[model samples]
Target: MTEQPVPAPGMFTLVLHTHLPWLAHHGRWPVGEEWLYQSWAAAYLPLLRVLQTLAAEDRSHLVTLGMTPVVTAQLDDPYCLTGMHHWLANWELRGREAATRRSGADTGYTEPEALRAFGIREQAEARLALEDFEVSWRHGASPLLRGLIDTETIELLGGPLSHPFQPLLNPRLREFALREGLADAHARFAHTPRGIWAPECAYAPGMENGYAAAGVTHFMVDGPSLHGDTSLGRPVSGTDVIAFGRDLRVSYRVWSPKSGYPGHAAYRDFHTYDHVTGLKPARVTGRNVPSQDKAPYDPERADQAIDAHVADFVEVVRRRLVSESERIGRPAHVVAAFDTELFGHWWYEGPVWLERVLRALPEAGVPVGTLSDAIDGGFIGAPVDLPPSSWGSGKDWQVWSGDRVADLVALNTEVVDTALATVDKALAQAAVGSAWSPRDAVADQILRETLLTVSSDWPFMVSKDTAAEYARYRAHLHAHATREIADALAAGRREHAERLADGWNRADGLFGALDARRFPR
Candidate 1:
C-alpha cells in the first residue's frame, strides 16, 4: 500500500455537514415520513448521541456542523414536531413487528419457509433503532447539541436555506439566498457563523463577494476545484473569505466515488433486496452482483469489515499527519469532510465506523479539531479564488440543475425575483405607515411565501428524479401564494388581503419574524 502523509502534532480539521431539506407541513406518512424518520433514526440521533457521549467524557472533538436555516425551520416547526411524534410511534410499531417475527412468536405474519427473510428485516429495523424513532427525533435538536455550540465543542457552520447549488443560480437571487440564509442562522442560533459549507462545497470564482457581504469569512470547496494541484487554505478575490479545499486524496481513503471502504465486499449491499419481501439480505464482495438479484445481508461479516476499515483509516490519518508535520516543520492538518448522512443513513455501518474512528483518533494520537481552530491556529496558508465547482459530478452543478431539470432554473429565477420585488414594495410601503394595518399581515404572508417558494429543493428534486411530483407540487403551492398576494394588493381588496393572509398564516406558519430587508436591493 502507498504510504500516507502525517500531520504535525497539532493539525487536523474535521467538518461534519448537518443538513436536511424542509419537510414541514409538506406531507406525512409513506415516502415523506420515510425520508424524515429514516434520517432521524439512523444518522442524526446516533451522531448526536456519539458527540454527547464524547463530550461527557471531556473529549472536545473540534468539528464543524452546518445546519441550514431551511433544515432548522423544519426541525423546530410545530407541525414537524407533531408529525414526528406520530412517525416515531409508528416506527416503534415496525420494530415490534420485526422483533416478534425474529422471535418466532407465530404472530400470523411469518412463514416457516421464510425464516431467513424475517431475521434479516428484524435485524435491519433493530439496527435502525426503529423503536426509538420518536425519542430520537424528539431529542434530535438536543440541548446537548446547543451545548456543543455554546461551549465551542464544535464550530457551527452556516449555509444557504435548502442548499441551493449557488454557482449555477442567478447572481442577484443567489445573493438573496446567501444573505437571508446567514440572517436566519443568526436569528435561530443567536450567533453569526464564521464559515459556510458553500452548498455542496460548490463555489464560483466571484462568489466570495456574497460571502463577504453576509459577513462569512470562510467557505469550503471540493479539492478538485483547485485543479487538484494545490494545498488547502487559499484566498479568493483578495477578500477575507478564505476558501478551504477538501483533501480528496485523504477523504477518498475513507469514502471513494466507486470503491470506498463502505463498499467493501464484507459490507452490506445498499441495493440487492430479497425477492420474497423488500428486505435487504446480502453483502457485496466486489462489483459482482447481477443486474437484478437479491443479496443476503450478513451483519457478522459487516462488523468485521467495519473494524478493518476503521483501523486502516485511523492509521492513514495518523501517517498523513506525521509525514506532513515532518515535511513542513509544523503540524499539517488533514481535513476529512463528508456528508453527515453517510453514517448509517446511506452506508448502513457508517455510524459504527464513526464511533470507532472518533475513539481511535484520540488513542492513536491524532486529535480531531474544527476548521475554525485550523484557521485560528495559523495553520492557514495563502488564500486563492476558488473556481466554480461543486462536490457533484466533476464538482459541477450537474447533479442539482442539470439537463433533466433544465426548465426549473428559469422558472425559479422569475418566481424568486418577482417575490423579492413584492416584498421590497410591501416593506417599503409598510415602513412609512402610521400603524400596522391588516395589509401588513398580507405582506407578511407574501414574504413567507417568497422564501418557501424560493427553496432550492424543487429544482434539486427534479434534477435528482426522486420525488419529482411532490417537488413540483410544493413549487406550485408557494408560487400560487406569491401570485395571489400580488393579485390581492393589485385589486385593492383590503378585506380579501386580510382573509388571504389569515388563511396563509394558518397553512404555512413558520419563522414569522423574518425581515425582508436582508435580501439585497
Candidate 2:
C-alpha cells in the first residue's frame, strides 16, 4: 500500500482575556483604581495600537479578545473616562519630576541623573497615551473595538457580568448572568457573542446546558481540564457547544507562572524600580542580584532579544503543529490563551514580541487565526464530559474553593443564597401589595453586590497571597453591601431601602440593562 501523507500540519489560535474588577469609585493608592489605569495605560492601549497596525495591513481574524461585561461597563462609563484622562496627565507630571531627580555618585548609576533618559521616555509614552485616550478611547472602548471588528481583524468573547466562578454558583444566577452578559455584548458590539472565555476557563460537568441555554457555542478551558489532550476543540456533553483547551506546552514559551520570555536578561527588570523617580532603570542582569546592582536597560539589546525570542516561538509552534498532527493521526489545533495584561504590564517587551510572533508564524508556514477560524477549518473532536476545572493553580477549582478560601466559599454561598431569596421574596411581595415593584432599585443593588462578592479574583488573590488583604477587604465590603440592602428590604423600609440602594449605585452603578425583574424566579 502507498504511504498516506499527513495533510495540513495544524493551526494556532490566540485568545487574550482582558478584565479588571470594577474600580471607578474605588481607592487610588497602593491598589484600587490605580490597577485599572495602569493596565489601561501599559497593556490595553499599546496592544490596541499593534492590532490596529496589523489590521491596516489587512490582517483579519488575528486573535480572539475577551472583555468581560464589567470591563465593558467601566470602559464606557463617564466617570472612568474622566479618571483615566487625569491619570494619564498625572503620569506625564511624574515623568517631569523624574527628570529632576539625580542619582548619588556612590550608586552604580554611572551618570548624574542617568534616569533622565528613562524619564524622557516615560514622558513621551505618557503623551502618546494621553493623545490615544483623549482621541480614541474618550467615549468608550466599543467604538475603537468596533473598528477591529469592522476590519474583520478579531473575534470578541463575552463572559458573565462579574466573572464569578460558575461551578460554585447557583445555577439560576449562573444562567441569568450568562444571558445578561451576552446581551451586554450585543449592546456594545452590535452582535451577540457566540463564545465566552468562561471566566478563568472554569468548567464543570453539565455546565454546557447553561451555555447552550444562553446560546454560547464555544468556550475555553485549561489543558489539564481535558486530560492534556488539547489538539482539538471538543464538544461538551453531546452539545454543539465546544470547549477548546489551552496548549500549555506552547503557551509557557511566552509566559508561564514560573518562567518565560519576560525573564530574559535583556528585558527591563519588572521588580527593580527607582523609588524616587518611579521608573525601572535596570535590566534583568541576574535573578538573584539586588535591584540596585542590576545593569541599566539598553533598548537595543532588548530589541535583539525580542527578535530572537519571536523566531524561537515561531519555530516552536511550527514544530508543535507537525508533531501533534502526526501523533493524533490528523490535523491539530494549538490554542494559546493568556491574560491581555501580561503584555506591556507584566512583560515590558511583550507587545513587541506579540506583533513579531504573530507576523513570523505565518511566514514560517505555521498558520495563525482566531478560535472561530479553527472551528470553521474543522478542528472539532468528539464530545467530552469535562471535569470541574479552572486555569488556576493545579488546574483545579482549589484556587477558588480550597482549604485556604473555605471561609470565602462559605461567604459566597451565604451571600448568594440570602440575596437570591431576598430578591425573590421582595419580588413576590411587590407583585401582590408592596410599595416597591419587581424591578425595584433596592433589589437590583442587592444582586449587584452579591455578584461582586463572588468574583473569582477575590479567592484567587487570597489563595496566591497576592494582595490578600485587599482581596479580603473587597469581598467583605461587597458582602456587607448586600446584607445592608437585604436587611432594609426585609424591614419594609422602602424609602430607606431606595436611599441605600442609590448610595451603593453611586460607586457600583453599572449594568443598566440588568433588570432585577428579569432574574429567574
For model 2, how does the per-residue alpha-carbon lDDT over 203-257 read when each residue is reduced to its tens digit? Answer: 8899998999888899999999889999999999889999999999999988888
Decoy 1 TM-score against native: 0.85
lDDT to native, each model: 0.69, 0.87
Q: Which RMSD values do the candidates have, in order?
A: 4.5, 3.5
Clash number for candidate 1: 26
What is the C-alpha lDDT profile of model 1 across 1-521, one tens digit per residue? 85543423755676778776666656764445467756765677677777767777777745788777766776766676677666555544554444344432333223323444545455666555544444555544634457778877778888875577677666766776677777777776777788998877877777898888778888888878866633347668799777777777778887877768877877766665433333344566568655243234567778888899889988887777777677766667677788888887778788888878887777677777787777787666665656667887757777667777766666667766676676677667766755542336666677677656756667767777778888888878887887787677767776887788778777777656654555455
TM-score of each: 0.85, 0.95
Off by over 4 Å in 2: 1-8, 104-112, 433-438
Residue pairs in clash, model 2? none
Residue 469 lDDT (model 1) = 88
